[model samples]
Target chain A: MSGASRQPNGSHAGGVPHDDDGVPGPGEMGGIPRGPEAPAPRPPVIHALRDAGLAALVAAGLFVPLVGLRTDVGPAGGGLILRTRWADVAILVALVFTGRLAMNLWSAFRPAKRPRTALRAAQLTRIGTFVAPLFLGFAVLMPLLPWTTRYGLDLGVLVLTYVMLGWGLNIVVGLAGLLDLGYVAFYAVGAYTYALLSTTYGLSFWICLPLAGIFAAFAGVLLGFPVLRLRGDYLAIVTLAFGEIIRVVLLNWVSLTGGPNGISGIPRPSFFGLSFSAGGEPGSFADFFGLEPSPTHRAVFLYYLILVLALLTNWVTIRLRRQPLGRAWEALREDEIACRALGINVTNTKLTAFAIGAMFGGFAGAFFATRQAFVSPESFTFIESAIILAIVVLGGLGSQLGVAIAALVLIGGFEAFRDFEEYRMLVFGAAMVVIMVWRPRGLVSTRRPSVALGERKAISGDLVGEGHG
Target chain B: MSAPILPARNAPILQVRELLMRFGGLTAVNRVSFDAMAGDITAVIGPNGAGKTTVFNLITGFYKPSGGEIVLNGPGGPKPLHATVGHRIAQAGVARTFQNIRLFPGMTVLENLLVAQHNTLQAATFFGIGAAFGLGRYRQAEREAVALARRWLEATRLLDRADDPAGALPYGAQRRLEIARAMCTNPVLLCLDEPAAGLNPRESEELAELIQLIRAQGCSILLIEHDMGVVMRISDRVVVLDHGVKIADGTPAEVRADERVIAAYLGEGDEDDVPAAPVEGAA
Candidate 1:
């Protein structure tokens, strides 16, 4: 085909409109009258009614059996007594109708010209830069706050662990564009490595931590090799299978692992050579610091330790994003065929992303085992993997700061919902829906390009494919 | 007539001998062959479904040839590319652009070029150790990489848009940027697929000059084009293919004069069914 044929400009040389066969051409409509002038667009009353009716039906189906009718047995005679909670059913139906109506109104009134990049992206980045240190300061003082309870410090440690895991998965899913649905397997490896080593050989947490990371990274390499040729859904399925295999082995292999009951009594990290223990022992941290023995001391130490580790994860990730390997990962994510055409060793780039990401996950896992003083297969299930993946996704993929904020908000928010008991997951699902509809590209939609020609400008996340994640 | 075609002053930088590509029963390419002399612009032109792109794929190592040899003359020895993988072929000094522009849309114009120099910059990173510490050696290499990127950017007149995402640039600018990105790899041979497909007259003219500029800088170019005007103006040699077979290969003037080439382009009349000539390159 000629080059001009491909032009989108809608022009063809030496062309004339014709109606030689007496079929009226596009510009020659004479017999039919044009319809009335366009009516001003009306509010979607019918659509709202339809939506409310559908919602009401769903509400009725869900709430009718539970709230609409109730049966009770008579205490003495064994006769049946029935009671109906009509109010509960009405409340459920009303809530559904109101929610549907509100959604319709919001959609109608929402601004039409949504810019690809949010206008407030720069402002948000500036605020993030300003608030980051303060956030870190708050984290550092969280355990020391006047209202700080043991639960607060424990929660802090949990949130930090997840934040670290999110950052690790972000390297694979975000930067490198490899969809890994089995990241928790690496975490399991790290935890088990420390548990087995410490329990078998009496090695300390400090010694096993790096060793755990190495083992996890090695596991990552093993996973990377077989899945190198797979992409997108295939890669995800294979990784998910790998994670399940690891958990199943941990569950069934009772000799090395403790089976479903899990390995317990894993040692907590000591303060270098000084253990955080009771009494005035020469080698105890409390004795050396001349302080009274308190469990809070150990809790506070773990908080700082995890905080440092999470920050290290963030630091290394940020540094790598600017390095050659990091750039290669991003490039591989953007267009793999193009990356290969550019002479990048795709196998190596993918492997590095996997190994480094798993290394961080392993470190977090080691900390987890020590924090709980136990290792279990249940802790490394597919759901945990899903949560970390969700954090990376809901945090706007490659944005490091986004991952931490997402982890804290999601994990801490879930923990806060403990009061709701059975309804916690329901509320969690609703929050996820609302957040996705509100900002589909996650909380932060701007990603700073790895290198900039002039000033470093953040690109709109909408412009990026979630790296096929 | 069966003697090998050779450039007068220098041996060919790339030679394709009887390259055959088949898909099941369909032979998309049938023992098609040609040679690209060093520092010259060779154009491959054919009608739709002429297996022109299949030939390009075979040479670039995107597809393994069904049979026959594709070789690159290197300093050390002949590099048999039919056995090499796509990335290794690129690393062996052959870089190519796709028919549809495949610029890394998410990356900035500058990052696209930086990625093209992945091998060199990766070495400087010392497997990421040197970069992790911001070592002097890695930093110097990075600086050089950036400098090389800027030079190519300036050459393509895309220095102003270096910070802009490659996808956001206008179509013509993206085409130029793709060339610049390929150049950043410092390729010995640049294969461009339809570089002028969507360009206006002015842009195509600019593209012709750009090809000349790249050739003047000691690189060889092999382009696939449907635009005869572009092919006629810039190509030192033109290879004509029809129905997966090379009908003519020679200087532009020589191919323009061949009867089979004329029959291929302008549909053959009932009285003028010219038999195809053997593959030949007039150096």
Candidate 2:
């Protein structure tokens, strides 16, 4: 069977003929000619074995969380309980397969005319599509659900926070082509800024948010001045160092930051005079708003608030990408010398990109502090930067839609696999490797040329030039 | 040269006085001095590595001259133009092209031209922030940029491909497009390096005509070309360089007859050993 599979024409291998050029000449090309066809090349068994070994390793990694869970539960209770969770695994697998299949089918039958309408429809579908899993989790697939409803809502809030962070980072790394490993430092700054201001000065969340963004923008400018001449790897390393410095300062400065323990009891966003807590009065938000007295309301509100912020981020980014400053960033990315020749002040351009990107990060950070009602240095780490960068790369660098899609797949997938606690990170790492191998340029690889001085058009023909200038 | 324009009684529009540019131990341009009169085509010709491009770079501010003054008789008065960077030089009405084309490859042809006029656009008061937000001044700048880009594209006969990436054009078209992009900056002195290099015979003739047309627009052109046909046909004055020194500078006929130029082309002391390539029937 292996030999038959290896043959060029399995049943008629002996009838094939070889030409000097390796391709069949004239009669051989036209019809079956009796001769020795080229010897069928054997499959590389070692390569196949290596691939199988890697796959097994990845599979083995998925059981790590289960092992951890088993140890926690003890030998008597662990085995049977682990067996029951297999149903949840099957449901997740089915959902992922269905999503892939649906995407393929939808793309195949997509309409050609009314392109604008189609684009709008596609966008609406994208926005509304997440409702499916949520509906299934809450209403339909109850047995497959691992956690109680309360923890599920908490997972949703966490995912929303990262989604906002991803969108903010996308502005710097994706649109501006500036590698900012220190982005989380700005986030930490915002959270601490809000935390300190509200706790000491008694400012509300609403007032502190914009103030935090302003402060972060100033910090961005401070960082930008020192690294104006740096580019590529040097710039990345400097920014990484800057992030560490911010974290270290926060840790060492005992008086201002409360040292490593971080500020606590940060204020939550309130609706007018009504608080979310039950003891505020019998006719507080829960009674007057005709809602259940549960912490889920606050979680839901924070989720939607972040959703709005994320939407704003997307809108502002799209607008900014079409503006002159945005074009200047892209020009600087393509060629700094040419950008300078065009009289673009490279220093100002770099600083603006840094400031704007940091401003958005600050907004998200302020929201995060309010949402959690606490802050800490542990929350902002180098791993957070890595995850944000991974989202941008996996989404395809310099593409807004791609970044959003990447965040959904990565952050959403990570959250969805929470029940498989032992295997979750393993699965995430394996997926990243597989993705890199399959699409080295990322999920949506192609990009439009940034400068559209006139109307945009499709680029045709190959880039033909010799020697770099 | 029929009495020059601006400054002194008959001062040249641009005067390079004993300009010297050194890179560490090597001197690229050694006390090279020349004057480009207004409304004339001055050709700088030399063999490979004869420092023709170095002269152009010094004049256009790509490299800072080690010594001597580059004086430009501005609309106000005669002044020593400081050895500034490329963008500042471009703003001072001196534009240049590279020996190898240096266009923004990923930008559209129109964008390439628009970027040339970036400094000229009347931006908003607050460092272009107000304009960037789609304010009135920004809208006008956009309209003007579009119009200017279209005019140059038309001039280059590349209007149909205006939206295409600059790198996608054919070789000759790319060369012409570079000239058009420079012209969009409204430069007083256009320095073209090897404008005829790599062009076919027909394209070379067309390029000569384009240079003549630009000269007709009252813009002084300083061209470095290896093609004798282009230099002899379009140049009102030709300066010959050898070993980083000016060997000859005069009208095409006068420079062609100079024995020093012949020696530079055929090499000294071997003039009898090697037959010189017949100069293209002197245009």
Candidate 3:
């Protein structure tokens, strides 16, 4: 990481004569304070003005098309046309100019020798103790709130499903240090398993859930075996290929999967054997309980079901991290050669990581299927895998709470940007870049030791190497 | 594997008979053979690239010997390690540390020891599914593992730093932690690849004491070292290697006086009768 700070100086090294790297060294000319090359510090006002001007120029260049222009259909439905919105562009540029000027002034007047933000490990771990449960409470109580609209409940279900997926991938990418780019293959497998079994064989969603997980785990082990010898980029490429292969198979195997059209009208989960049907039908939840029938009960049931499943995933992952196999996987990530030297069966360990990670992916897939009442090839695209991978990584690998919060923030934030139309991805992408630059290891970068002897201290992420395995 | 053999007195715990390793065209270890007895600190000292570490690697199953056999006489009798799978070699009662420190830097000191005992805990956890639920047998197994790690940590004097990351320790402490980790595997034969490679005199003295302690516990040792101060003091026997073959083997004092061992250390011709080997003390 110390090596990383060099880039900041390197970017500005074109004109600046960095005598001793970037850090100002001791007085060079026999302890003299100032040399001929040194210039007196400029006034803060002038500096701020120059910076704002440059920032306005750069902002104008950056927002060339999207800023001042709006594209829409002509007055009628005749043809497409462009409408210029110069005021909006000017406002955006002015905001950038002011922001840059303020930033320049702040830096110019700030005290010297300030502490950096590198002490985040201590603060984040301290926050994790309370932040995790506080978030859980809010999530649990969300649906019951009177203000939570039906759309809000639906979005909660979506976010929780992703949270589950993020945790599942955390086992492979975060814990085991295997970069799996094709995790959605397992997701697709689960969805299709539930879809095909329920639609064709008349199995209940409950029966197919476990079966879906088993089949996906089988797929995991299958994929794991051939790629056991691969590591790093090779493993990622192969897994990415596996995900694509699954999607292609689902697309072409139309009789089994409905091609691009997908399988629909899949059964929703019941209150046990009782369906959540309206009009008080026989064996329906309302009829069995002798209560008022409302569709909200079904939505609440699904929310709680997914909440339970996500918690289960979280619970299982925490337990596994302290176990021998979990330790072996982590050790393998730390130093595979050392792991082999210690008599660990690397193949079995790696396989189990993949299987378990895929197993959860499978469960989440089943949930996605039942929730949507649909299974389509289009839904299990590379982007889903990328988003899940992004969630796992951006959450800080192996940190469960971090992954949950990251999923919520990312999914909910993505949804929040839905109104931005095509610019949503672009804006979200810029946010991700800023985040990566600020904290490359994810939001929860400091890792809590799996087990501790005394008062637990968070291990700095710098100490641990990514499990290139 | 069954535990039936009770070795005769002075028997070789590890017998390497004409082990040969060839990587493409280079003979890294060529037809070398030596015996490490039941309770001895046998040091293999040679110049750089003299196949000292190569022999350790071959014995540890990092490489399959091109020919001949390497066997360790555990409580289960002689197990041929040459043909066993790479990982099973560790299970076959042999453990080794690298020339460079290879501690899992991210893990706690105790966790490093715990990982070495994974094959044991893994079975007790029923392939670890039982562990995810914190079920019956796994809890006991993990407790036993922690106790075992505690023992090694105590032995290596790392108990105080047990909670610290392995990488955060001082260099000498990391070396000790690596040995502690290797010992946690419960090996009958321990191979130390330059165990004292980067230690100060006092630290090396402490390392020699640790080696003696490991031998006292009935685990035989095979070490590659350049530190003659350590070798001359603690090693019961020394095997000198030159260009991939064993040139001399005997008590450290006897090997120290051998002409070829001197030549290997000094090159071809004599330099006015000066002692060539950095033997502890010689004017």
Best by DockQ: 1
Q: Tell me which of candidates 2 and 3 scores higher on lDDT.
A: 3
**How many Å off is the CA of B166 in candidate 1?**
1.4
Instruction: Using TM-score as the measure, name the better of candidate 1 and candidate 3.
Output: 1
Each prediction's Cα RMSD?
Answer: 8.5, 12.3, 8.3
Top TM-score prediction, candidate number: 1
Q: Is the docking of candidate 3 incorrect, acceptable, medium or high quality?
A: acceptable
TM-score of each: 0.88, 0.74, 0.85
Candidate 1 stretches greater than 4 Å from native? A1-40, A43-96, A109-119, B1-9, B268-283
Instruction: Compose the digit string of candidate 2's lDDT tens values, residues A378-446.
Output: 888888888888988797766665676677788878877789899999998999999988877676554
C-alpha lDDT (0 to 100) for residue A214 of candidate 3 = 99
What is the C-alpha lDDT profile of model 1 across B1-283, one tens digit per residue? 0112223425788899998999999999999889988878999988778998898888888899999899987444579999999899889888898888888888889999999998998888888987898889988998899999999888898887787777777777888999999989888889998887777677777888899998878788899887777787789889898989999999988987789988787365532343221111100
Tens-digit per-residue lDDT, B105-146, candidate 2: 766787677667666553431445565466777767667777
Lowest lDDT block of 10, candidate 3 chain A? A1-10
Give the per-residue lDDT digits (tens) of candidate 3, residues A1-469. Answer: 0001111110111321112335555555466655477577888799899989998999988776867878889999999999888888888999999999988988888888554343553354445676777888899999989999998998999999999999999999998999999999999999999999999998999999999999999999999999999999999999999999999999999887989999999998887799988778889999888889999889999999999999999888888888887788889889999999899989998999999999999999998899899989999999999999999888888889889988998999999999999999999999888888888999888666676566445566888778885
lDDT of each: 0.84, 0.70, 0.84
TM-score sort, best first: 1, 3, 2
Question: TM-score for model 3?
Answer: 0.85
Q: What is the Cα-based lDDT of residue A6 in candidate 2?
A: 12
